[model samples]
Target: MTVLGHASFFAGRPVVEVPASGPLPAVDGPVAWRIDYPDWDNRTDETPSPGFRDRFDRFVDQTGESVQALVVGAWGYAAFNPAPIDQLCAAAPRLPNLTALFLGDIVSEECEISWMRVGDVSRLLVAYPRLESLRVRGGENFRFSPVRHGRLSRLEVESGGLRPEFVRAVLDSELPALTDLELWLGDPTYGGDTTVDDLAPLLAGQRFPALRRLGLCNAQIADDLAEALAAAPVVRRLETLDLSLGTLTDRGALALAGGQPLTHLTMLDLSHHYVTDEVVATVQATLAGVAVNLSDPQTPYIEGDEVYRYTVVSE
Candidate 1:
């Protein structure tokens, strides 16, 4: 198992890492397969190494249809290339067992999160009908036309800022088995135009009947989100709520404490916020026994003219 640490560019936050266990055995169960850059040192170049395509082909050949949960990292300057999903789709027949796919596992050194240009992933979803979980990082030029898939249980899009159209596509799509949904509603400067109104369908509990976990994170307007979530019907039904890695402040924490009955939730993640220790303690006390994470409080500062507090990860 190779543990890869995903250290936050933002200060004070913990370095979260995922263990990559690879060279999977041909078994009839979930197996994690990692596809990394052929040459890590020269990843900034536009073209991939001659061996890169061969390596993926080799992986498909060796895995022999018993592979699931593929993690793709650094496809040699992915920002400049078409989405790697296209390539995976071409090899879909060989990876009949694949269910979970984590794309863009590239770190800051390989490509800045905001700089990673992703293309339409609709074809990839269509290619693999059995895909249950899809986690994608990077959002510039990202798109997904309305799609319907019965097996998808989790969909996580981690972008510096996600496009509103992508959010709309998810809302309009048919995902009957979707239980977990995480969207990083990043800074507006990076194309994140989704407002509280855009999330009205999800917040009203009118969509995704199986959704138990909801993450509206990495937001610039965390305070407004908190206020909206307090009154959202979906909050009452959720088992886990994540409002992390954003600019959540004391006002937001107060709204959560005073407005909502979050005791029903098993976990509430409000990590990487601008809220004070006192407010965090109060909120934790209010939601007693509800496994709350309020780490990495940001210290507000004054930039040239206006005071500023940033989301955890943005270019």
Candidate 2:
């Protein structure tokens, strides 16, 4: 069953029931509410709006079942410069039912000067120790600490550059239940000089034991870096791998598919980048068992920027 917000156009009415006799797709178990609000970046006042938060809290209060996940836009008033973002994340631990958090536009210029404030979100992340999947967008201010949370299964890092300390934190946490992992470079500051070698030690070995789905988007992947992933055990169980965007050339492509354990991959997205059709074909032939998508013109590749997410999704 889907819960409609009182302010929603579909609110104040029961969800339409389907006939038992008719065929219907099974609902993906666990439902969540998505709350979107305005932002200052769009040329609004700098302060966040209160109306949005009021509506958001109302939706949560009316929600009956344990919310499997929550897709939230902004925390305070404006989605752009929300002041209460930390407050909402802090509430995550209280929502025992919440497991997954999908955040959007988390990093904006408003918090650029003091990225440390976003650390509040990190504290809330620890609250949901049983969280299964996590995706962060916008800025890279939030630090991933080594707080032990055994139930976390999947982790996706988008945009923002992660700190070296966070890598050790992840390893020390001992995420025994983790299965899928994704890392995309956003707003690259180092250019061609940036190598995965800097990131290897963080995720190389026993760190991500159960990782499966690996998506590397809009990052600079050098040949040696790609080879490093091939050598890592993290690539063994990957079922879906996406390496799209950025300045990845044929060298990186070959290194990734030359001889690796990414045989079970079912979906692959390689959009943008300078890798030619020949390189793609070579990777395909190398991993004949995996289904691959070379490119999607509609989604133009981003060079070095990151995407910030703040919405919650249902399980």
Candidate 3:
């Protein structure tokens, strides 16, 4: 049988790629697993074959208590299926070592980033009590029911547009160990209803005391977000801050440059923005030791009567 996927590593941990064929790896210490079906778009329908589940079950059987991270790639196209999560949950007793998960790793070839459907992720969190990191891509129809997990430390959601309800769900969650939080607030056209006001609690430092890294990215109103973050108490304690893949302009860059708290951060990410070269230079100079990312500067354009600034990812 042809091996569908291969195994690799990131930061010394093993990463397993689940392809359409081949036997699951029996090696231990698999930190991540990516599920991908290359023939998804060409298939007659989106429903995955029984072989998919069989492979997953085999993976569970082979890895049992060793796998720590799971990355779900394209699965036959019909939105994303929660069946894998259900399978993992049902076998949680044997997979107690699982901790990190990245859902919806599909690209434009399989499905547009904004078009990928996301179901409620509450059950997944509840099932994995030892989960330390959870990253999800795509936001259409995404929902997160209020839940608490003691070991969850990193939470990231990337989307063309993030809904307010989802943000509210994170805000309401009881994650005492959460230290890294990244939310991609995409363009308003793709269901992004959250405003800076909705993030007031996080900005005010009234939540997530253990948070050391924060990312408020892929925003349309990045300038406003920067302004809010500049004055927020949360910035005072963050070790890393990310405001990338957004329409950030000089106004936002200035807010960060002028801010005192940002100087203390070890790293600052401001890539894929609309800031001028001069502003980038100024911000970089201000935060001397901080590793800054100021790549992919965007030029403002005019389409019809209104000015247009695009986010890095949008349908």
Q: Which portions of model 1 show Cα errors greater than 4 Å?
A: 1-30, 38-51
Predicted candidate 3 versus true structure: per-residue lDDT over 158-224, tens digit per residue: 8888889989888988888999999988889988878999898899999899999999998997999
lDDT string for model 1 (247-283, tens) is 9999999999999699999999999999988998899
In model 1, what is the error at residue 104, expressed in angstroms? 0.7
Please report, as a residue range, the 10-residue window in candidate 3 with the lowest summed lDDT: 1-10
Total clashing pairs in model 3 = 1
Candidate 2 deviant stretches above 4 angstroms: 1-30, 41-52, 76-85, 105-117, 160-168, 190-195, 222-224, 261-264, 297-315
lDDT of prediction 3: 0.77
Q: Evaluate all candidate structures by whole-model CA lDDT and list the values in order.
A: 0.79, 0.52, 0.77
Q: What is the lDDT of residue 183 in candidate 3?
A: 94
Is candidate 1 or 3 superior in lDDT? 1
Could you tell me which 10 consecutive residues in candidate 1 have the lowest summed lDDT?
9-18
